[model samples]
Target: MQRRFLVGLIGANIGKSLSPALHEDAFAAAGAQGYYHLMDLQVLQGRATLESLLVAVRTAGFAGVNVTHPVKEAVLPLLDEVSPEAREIGAVNTVVIGRDGRTAGHNTDRTGFRRAFEEVLGGKAAARQQVLLLGAGGAGRAVACALMDLGVQVLHVFDTDAARAQTFAADLQGRFGADRIRAAADLAGAAWQAAGIVNATPIGMLGYPGMAIAPELIDTRHWVADVVYTPLETQLIATARRKGCRVMTGGGMCVHQAAEAFRLFTGLEPDVARMHRLFNEACARRDAKLAAAG
Candidate 1:
């Protein structure tokens, strides 16, 4: 019998997510039967809680599900097991349902961000050896861990919730060393001294439309990256580019992460180049629709 897999994405405001197309197309290219569903909490309208959805999907024989945004951290404790990387990052973006009917949480965000940075930015952003990371949330945690893996000398983190930023820095300090990471109380000061700036918050995303840091804080000396892919060209990215700063969009991260998730789901290697092409096509369609609507 041919192998088949059922996977899904669980998050809010995910109606326009490109994950389904990305993973399903990869499965098609690999000649496997695959179905990717979206469990959008906003769309479900209180019909399901995160716990309830996980139970439903597991019971329905789902191979696994990808967790995102608000639920990435929330889904961690609910899993039967968590990979070391995910545990270290304190977030989980991908979950695998084992044959023994147990769920294991893993994070592809770290590898995804690492690949995107090396491939898209050509590692130029890390040249200064220091980076300013905005938002110490789930995505921020993943990126922070990736930066350490990439050999960043210093990471200055700032979050609207100062406590969250300090906590994230403290957690990473245990792994990357106390001198390598610090929580920043002044975003402008950190951005001024860093080689790159990363926005890991939802500020630049579709529902939340704004830059995490002021455009004035960005300069040619800085490379800016945002994890908000829906807009493709967020205000932060555009501002950075206009200022002659190298900018990496969230699209590359999204595609790379989905490619990793596809591998986890199917145990088969996916053509990442093909996935990137599909992602670009999807983004073009979304942009055109937004333009026509305006």
Candidate 2:
């Protein structure tokens, strides 16, 4: 009998996510049957919450689910166990369901972001320059750790919520040191002081259609990276590119994280090369569809 697994992704504004296609192809290549469901918060808004969806998926015998966006940090308390790394980062991107129905959460975002940064930027985040990070939320936490691990000398964290940014910086200070990690009070001021900018927030994605930082603030010398993949070339990425700045799309992190999540869900090694190939194809298709719609 062929092995079968049911998994899901829970997030908002994810109607365009290609994770379902990627996972299905992976399962077929490995001779297993898989069903990947998308539980878009945009669709389930009033009907369900992250807490309820976690319970629902678990009760329905789901293998696991990938948590994203606003809920990555919110899902932590709902899990029976969270990996030490995730506990430290205060976010969970992947969860593994045990045979006993116990759920354990882990973070693949940190690994995924790190690998992507090394590949795309050749580890430029480690250039020993002061870096500015926007959005000190779930994804931001993972990116912050990855940046530090890559030898980033100093990191300034900023968010629309001033207190949240300050709190996140305070939490990371114990591990990475207060001198290296700081809460940025001024957006333009932080950008002026940093060498690179990382948007860990959802601002550049589809429904959230605006660059976190202004265009004029991004100079040609500043390298920029955004964690929004839907429109591969987000406004931030495009702005950085036009200024001749090195840039990274969220696609790398998306595919790499999906690969890690697949391994955790099915205990199967993922063909990362295949994922990259499919991801590019999917993006091309998405672009074409958008063009046609217009």
Off by over 4 Å in 1: none
Model 1 agreement with the true structure over 1-294: per-residue lDDT tens digits: 768999999998888899999999899899898999999998886688999999998899999999997899999889999999999999999999987679999999999999999998876558548899999989999999888877888999999999988998898899889999999998888988898999999997878888899888998988888999988998899899999988899998999999999888889999999999999999999978976885
lDDT of 2: 0.91
Off by over 4 Å in 2: none
| Per-prediction TM-score to the true structure, in the order listed | 0.98, 0.97
lDDT string, candidate 2, 137-209, tens digits: 9999999999998899889999999999989999999998989999999888989999899999899787788
Residue pairs with backbone atoms closer than 3 Å in model 1 (clashes) = none
lDDT of each: 0.91, 0.91
Model 2 TM-score (2 dp): 0.97
- For candidate 1, give the lDDT of residue 234: 87
